[model samples]
Target: MLNRTAKFLTICLLAQPLPPAALTVTAAASENAALRDISKIQVDERRLTEAVASRTLTWLTGSPANNDYISVGRLANFFGFVGLRVTSGHSLKRSEVARETLSVLTEQQRTQMVSLVHAQKDTLNRAHEARQEMNRALEGLLAFEHVTREQFIELGRDYGAREAELGRLLAQTFGDIAQTLSTDQQRALTDIRTTHLSGERRQGNGGGDPKLRQSKADKKELVNLTARFLSWTTGSQEFNDFEVVGKPSQHFGFVALRIGSNHGVKRGLVAKEVLEILTPSQIDRLREAALQNAREFPMFLEVRAQLMRVLETSLSGGVIDPAHTAHLGAEIGEIEASMTWSQAAAMLDVRDGLSEAQSADLLAMRAKYTAETDSSDLDDPIERGRQLFAQCAFCHNSDSRQPIGPPLDDIVGKPIASDPAFKRYSPALVRYARAQSMWTEAQLDAFLKSPKALVPGTFMSFDGYEETDDRSALIAYLKTRK
Candidate 1:
């Protein structure tokens, strides 16, 4: 209902105008009436379209962060306990720990630890390989306008299997690593991890932070913050998938505290993400804002409820009443203006506050995180088909509903315009459907290439696809709808 296109940078936040005084109720009363109406309204949640989910998820991917936020002391403890060498009072590369064994452990223990490490290594490598494979699979899916259920499910299964195998090996490795350490060393490790890994998993955390231990109150507040963000973004917390929280965010231009894109893990705890970033001062500011924001967030929600109320009460039966339209539009118009101004102000503040170096860093990070435009997903036939399909969507519903134009659903195998339910089809298509047995692939291709040529008197106004590849792709997409 809001005008997303208009810039409201110069908006004046004057008191919102009342619904034309002729309305029997005051502004406060109208809004209260709307709130009550909406409170009782029940509607099914809307899940994102598959194409949107895939595309957003793809954007969330690309280059993963590959570094440490952990402290040196914790790192030394972890390495030493894991049977890795950590010479005292000497700075060494983090990778150096992987190459050498601690002299404190017996040779037999070393041998056992090495074997366990080798097994862990193999499992980790396999998971990495599967992730690479899954990346390719996702690339293909994102490029397609339409995909069969089997395609997404099959790829998800492949990735799920690898994640499960990796998780099992990782758990085993933790126990095995502890076994190699002396009791005192194991205690040292536990003490070091007390803050860093408290309530957090130790495996593959993108080299997590040691400074991220949170109090119960802090953890509860973070949970509430996460719930609010999810609500704002997804329109509902339930509007989510069982994919890795971070992975989908890679696509959706947001961040999630999720671990990986393995099955069933919806998100990473907000505390872990904070630990990963380890910017406590900024986090404190954000947390304070979040607490305040969450309490006030309901106002924006009520705006939506208020709009729906206006639409319902203002309309005459199923049609808009010209008399009420002006009043209805004004209420929505003010809300949109305020929101636009606030959003623009936030961006402006960021832009104004950034130093040249910080700006450059942000630019560079954005570049690194963004997917390569020339990636294979760009060249996939399904992607090309999807781009072409957007033009057609203006007139056709894939699900064959809404009667805006003839639906393409089942148009591949069914005789053209033969649906007894669809009377809006042009007479030309009607006659053709009566004469033709079924719409073959060749027929679809030819029709897409030149609709007017195929049926001279057709009511359809599409300027057909001029390129052979475009028509072929269109026909290919249509064929799969059945």
Candidate 2:
């Protein structure tokens, strides 16, 4: 039924393709159909994945201006009033208000908030998965040369089902949180909500510009502070770890937010501690790394802005060449990779000279927020692999084009470096592939254990999964793709 409807709509669209006015009408009709379908469909709980859940909650609770179009400032305010602080002012530095909110909470209150968030994690993930399913349907529609109104409607219907399910879960979670809040907490939250809704723009120092008061020294200090905070959060100096094909810092940022919004509390303390132990030469190396990051970080943001423009154009129904999007994605990926790599290398160079006690202090600080995976709940290898694959999403699109690396579709048993579409495989990998032929489960396991070990100088920059179970789970998950 969908295929026939799509075919008919496509024919109708193509019939009057010459007129701009006709095209606009057809687009509007399609959009209406999609919206109508969205209202009618129901969500399938079984198909929801963790990635979808994480994204859904993040989007639902993020800032409207920065996170994504679906982000609602009101939702962010609500979450911020609680323990989570996913959204903040437009700055790389951590939000002072968010930190203060969490700090003011009693231990019991913080624990309650954490438990509530964790309890709702599964439901949020399912909703997120539903949205992802809708997006996949949309992608399928977009693949057609002339997408039809009926196709849009059909896609909408599928999405509508998911949305309905999502709405139910979200409402329940919200009510649960609201009912759990103490009277005092509720009152404070109400005040915070009013402040957000007021939309007051007071001129603190003539026209409300805060940066005008900053001295050159203050600005330099901020840059160094940001660089150090990022480094501490990541806790890695491996260049390979940072050179992946997406915004690497975002993962760190999100981790900090989800854990406890602890960045604000720990960043300054860690910076001071590290400085106390650093030798003059180590200090110089660290400073150089901070300066490099301070430089590249802006360029990374600018490239990201460019990518956003391309996406906006496409979303606006403008005819976009896929190659253009791919080019920009690649460009932004490289800039982010370079920035992270420099920051990591600098941290490594400085940390190399740290005494045992100094090393322990850094480790102790890191352990405060670093969460270990709870294997009890996620005992399924495929499920665990799916969760672990979030990091890999930065470089590889499983169901779509291999934007950075070869697509993983039917990767199991495939010959290495043989995806004709992925032309940028390192020569070393190709030679190894020719020698070894097919990527057997054993070969894949070995490769995942250490990419460089299997094929020296391989293009894959992953540091490898050290845990046997992790490697096995990832491999098992990869096999299920087909």
Candidate 3:
């Protein structure tokens, strides 16, 4: 046990963040160096390199939602916003001065817009659920050795229909919002859209500057290494889940950590608990689990990469055909799911194995970490909400520049599923909305307590704020969105 501990320490020491080197066609020099070091122990340098490259390519071409080889998400990226800049900042922030200058929605206009959005909620929800179900079904078909072309075409047709419905809903909402806008407001939005488009064009001119891409790639590699280290140590699904370790994403590693529970505070705290509080027996078990994960990691990567290649080649004709390729995609999805499940299982095992004293010690460490990280002003719930909302910014848009989830501005007392700019409320949320006339404070509180519990099929990825104070503060902050 002592030798294993020493060996693990040495490996971690060697894995310490190193200075990034220049990029190469195949892989960044720094990445190769890091992988080479790991290869000496468990990973296969070449196979891992190929996998990483495929993963990176998959990210480059995929949507922000999912990194599937071929799915509605990828299709959305391809057919939805092929070369658009799609502004990253909030739409409300367009004006440096008074907020109303850019977004001139009166209470009446807001109400009308909200009503229009609400009307489409059922259709949008149904379409979204259909797409989701189709994706899942398609994912299941991957284990099969063969799939007919007709199968891919049929799935493609369904995916296309669902995607088209979503697009129509978006367009309809935008049209309704535009009708509500006066001439000046329309001009303001047009100007913002034009500026964003120009910026996108410039970015695409030389692939947004090779230097920028290279720098980003280098940093991403290091970030990936750190996340991988975190997973190997803690086995927390937050750092090692399906989206983070199981699949490739442009927004993997640190970026993905933003939406995790407790805003991922547990990630930093878990290592301390494992190192200082865990028993010798527990550590030995964790070490063995880590070793087992390390051994399996390379094979999963290799198979996933290979599957991605097969899917890409089979479906490269600018058509959404899933057939045999869907099988491969499904297999990839399964591998990703397995990766997540295995780590989560290991984490649960360790958790179940913990002594009450050890668990108490870990909880104490967690409380300490949470307190240390709590920089919000206790006296001001709104202020605290503003600080805490960082966890939410990733999914919810503060402004109206195409939200991943929904716009939160003036959400309190507003009709549920009534964001003019967002039309993709899940069926569960829509059902919950039908029972409630508006987003009452109590409803928000209960929903925030556990979103899935309140609205089971809602696609809001947040696990909900557990602390009552935190939830209150966030609701307070949200009340000020108007």
Candidate 4:
């Protein structure tokens, strides 16, 4: 009779009705409270753990992983669960079992769960902020000799104890809510917690306590300097240039000084520094505008200054002198003249005053620069060609994997048809690949000299190289692969 009664009770438990609406509302409220408490606990515990871990690892092993990766709140939550499991003696293999036990909620109940989860996440974010504040305080305290390791550890221990108590209370509250819920409601709550809460916990692990990287005064000064430099460089109203033929005549001397002062440019390094600082976007825009207008546009002084600084920092020697600056300005003018209108428009994303042909030219230029090449001989030109190749290098380099033309890395050995990553190949070139076996050095040399004639439908717009010596030198240089 007792066995039958036990069996009846089990059936009744399984057949229990869906929870009352009130129960779900209460559970959601309780879950939110629990999560908030858990967040605080986790954050506090994380701080303690990080301090201990950093000290132990540094002392014993002479190295430690970056403490910046640690999140006290997350660690607290994980350990809190471990503590709960320990106390309850629940030997569930996975949190999924708990979810399944709570899975019978309605759509409304699920939404409530989501709302609760969001609330929990917000609390965790606040907790993170608090942790950061504490860390900053601790960092400041470290400057003093009176605050010893023992004191730090003691403080951490206190934080940990408080966290553990919070966790215990949350677990107790959750258990109480679970008891009141119907079997279905319990399952829904479990599912929500497992999916939503679990994700929050995982994300909480890496957001380290914020450190005070700079003083307010320093930050303010930096901001001011940046604004001034940007205004001068970007052609903002502050350093307005005098207009010549509806275009601004750049203040070259002022630009040079700005570059020198900001970047510390000397003689030999000035030209190179200036070139390096000009972004592909800036150059392309300038070049296109020059081509379209058939005139030189003054460079923004602010832009020049920024470029100079970048150059000075990147190179060994200081900034450029007057003569070199003039030379650089001339070179820039020549390059700008060679730019097609289309290229300029593309850079600025401006359609004003640009012809279709100019737009087409810009697109073509961009395509040429972005396109991949299989020619191994492209980089190595003969000794005489080396000087000439410098012109080409203005738009190309190994560092950026982008030049005004395709990257020449591993071009020599690469099969013509195999590399799909090279998107710049003309349709004619693609067809040629199908017809030919591979691109050899000799074949590349011939093609470079007369691209359109070699591959009639090829999109290469450059006039073929007229000098055989130039072609041969270019080929020879290309042979010496890096």
Candidate 5:
């Protein structure tokens, strides 16, 4: 907990009035202070969050009347968006904005989209159910100290298959909606997906973000500053269950954060990276925009967090009270009333401020950093093995340090329970080791290929690589031993 003195200082720093300095960030300290303040406010206002959340249950029923655009077919996704609403600031409020194209559409066209969304309730429900099952499996991992090898392997496979089925159903639902839109509206939709929704300012970008990292020290400070805002993201199991199941994104990707629900992209770190190519004047503009964004983020994030709790709870535990849902709507209205819609326009200023060539470079840089493998290196088994090891990097360190799992250092020759550095070995693994002592290549292969069948209660959360070559490659890399 922060001292009262410290917390008040932080709020003062953030709320300090800035001089009217168009694009220039006149006070860097004030900007930093605002960000810290906003993050703190988001984290500390627990009751406010719950109160607002109790009102958003209406979201489960249908889109409410608002200045915001609505489509019956897109309602589920809209609900998801509302759940994700706090990432940006400004006119993106649940109120305040509407799509010009959507506004002009005929009632019948709107009804068609809603009808299509209604039609897929069964498919969506199935996907939701499968996801719940996976969440239960993952919850087991969270509850126990060590995952049995069998649990680890089976959970991996089950999670992957479930995701695939859900993805297909969602794709079909979205496709049906897309088909209903006119060409112009379709273009508008694409623009929303690729442009307005995309925070990228540069042009000619193929796709994906560069996996640039900022200094660890700076990032640690950013994390501390935003710890409150990050509490639910990093600590909430419900939030964790809903995050994307794929590999962590390489760079700041298409979305701001790909580091799982653990944290938002270190915005200060990303800002440092993105600002590198911009001119000094452009840097000032972006800085100003960031500071302005800081002002509204605290309120926005708090409301969104509460709403997420409501949604995730409903998804897992069934519907919440209607009164809470109504309160949430009221909260949204309150926040919208006070918010100054500057960030989006400021974002545009930053976008237009950048030269076209810089945009191209930014795009190219991200694409280069996108998690693409070098085709030329495919012939080398060792190279392929290293490539296959990336997924494991999420939880296991090659060094002696344990991440989520034991380190891989000299793992090939290690006695099952003999690694002195690892203090919390699973009992199942220890008992298995009594019969077979060492981690031989065959044991490794089977474990890597299918962990659940091999050791049912092990704590490893990875799904085994089904491809023979991929598993071989990963094993090959492991043999090298850091």
Candidate 6:
């Protein structure tokens, strides 16, 4: 009875399908459809073989002889059967055969073939890593979950089924390459499928307490974190593992900190700190800004979503591991934060316009506020503006010859309405230019603060500069242009 049961188990294991191999085969089949015509050529197999062999020899030895003639004769005989007359024309040459084969492939078919090959290569690599991870997780299960060897194996099978499902989805969505897979590749995939199946069977039959099962779920949750971190770092949503555990609500102070801490944002320090940061007025402005700058700032929605997620994560006791935390911090630091309204209108230097009492009032309102004296005279306004303009490099170029927008070089001195070469300018701009004088530094500064407001009909769709300093720096930088 024992031997019979063992044999039954082995049979069950052998019956399980190999997902990677299946996927590989699927891809291979797709490629073979295009190669089939070439393969079907009715050539004298021996002669064609000899010709290929002699050609390889000639390449290696740098010599041609009677033996090569024999190979050529064989090739000619093969071509004769195919109705290709080598003696009459060059149509029967080897290069001609290659050209014919290439000509037979449609553009779409060629693209599909290349895509399939690349997908297969990537899938093979990922599947290998997945298998290794599955194995390691199983081995470590004893340490992490205190499960028996049988239990561990059973758990592995369940995970394998889930992985197989993912693989199937990937193959369907990304295209399959299994038909082209080699025997060895098929064998490896088969082994993985078999192992997973065996594990699933074990888990189903070896029943355990409900509480223990719950604990297993918790352990899986932790293991999932590692997977999620990897996915996040790799910039793919398919491998998303993190789950939001709480409800979303607005908490201005919390929102401010979260936004500040976010990777690549550095704006709204004091206003964000205000307990009621998003006041009715501020909210209206933001909504209007969103509407006005929708095209220029399509990524705002994504940024806001991430901000909410960070808020939820912070409120919950869930700590993103140190590595992920550091990476997020770095990304946030890279962002050039916008200034508040007051900051934008401040004097360019010396702060002569602001009274001490006004400055003190601003500092008193914020929980964390520190004032730094600008006594060093090291603040090169042009250099500061250049630093701020770095953020705009992704979508704009200062060089007029190569730019998404009209180049800013010598833009200040140009006539408001004329530049025939600038085809992309909005009609509103041409109208404005016809009516108004050339753009002055102060006018440019205000326009930079709120682009839509100044020229409602213009196409310069940037979300207005968020900070007074940033706007000033940008204006200063623009002034340096001839």
For each candidate in turn, the TM-score is: 0.28, 0.32, 0.31, 0.24, 0.28, 0.24
Q: What TM-score should be assigned to candidate 3?
A: 0.31
- Write candidate 4's Cα lDDT for 1-482 as tens digits: 00111111110011111213211113442354233321122112222222222121111111011111231223223112322222122232233322232234334433333333333444344434433332322322221113343443333333333333332332232323333445544334344333333333322312232232445643332222222211111111111211112111111121222232442323224323322334455434444443433321222222222223222221222332334333333332232222212221232232222333433444343232211211222343454344334323322332223323354545565566455554566678788878775768777777878988889987555545666766777566556544
Model 5 agreement with the true structure over 1-482: per-residue lDDT tens digits:
00111121111122221111101112332243212222232322222222122111111111111101112222122122321223222112221112222342345644443444445456555534543333333222222223343443343333333333332333333333333445554333334322322333324222222222436533332222122111211122222222110111101122212122133333334344555666777555544544443444454434434544443332222444445543543453233222222322233344444443554444444333322222222566665565445335334532313334566767887788786766677787888889889999889889898887787787654557676777677678778855
Clashes in candidate 6: how many?
26
Q: Could you tell me which 10 consecutive residues in candidate 5 have the lowest summed lDDT?
A: 58-67
lDDT-based ranking: 2, 3, 5, 1, 4, 6
Any idea how many clashes model 4 has?
A: 36
Candidate 2: 10-residue stretch with minimal lDDT: 3-12
lDDT of each: 0.35, 0.39, 0.39, 0.33, 0.37, 0.31
In terms of TM-score, which candidate is strongest? 2
Better of 3 and 6 by TM-score: 3
Query: Mind giving the per-residue lDDT tens digits that candidate 6 earns over 426-465?
Result: 7887777776768877767777888788778876646577
Prediction 4 global C-alpha lDDT: 0.33
Residue-by-residue lDDT tens digits, candidate 1, 435-480: 6767888888878888899988887666476777767766776566
Candidate 1: worst 10 consecutive residues by lDDT? 236-245
lDDT of 1 at 80: 20
What are the per-model C-alpha RMSD values against the true structure? 24.3, 22.1, 21.6, 31.5, 24.4, 30.9
List residue ranges in candidate 3 displaced over 4 A: 1-272, 314-321, 368-482
Stretches of model 1 off by over 4 angstroms after superposition: 1-113, 120-122, 194-244, 247-482
- Model 2: lDDT equals 0.39
Off by over 4 Å in 5: 1-377, 398-402
Report residue 82 deviation for candidate 6 (angstroms). 66
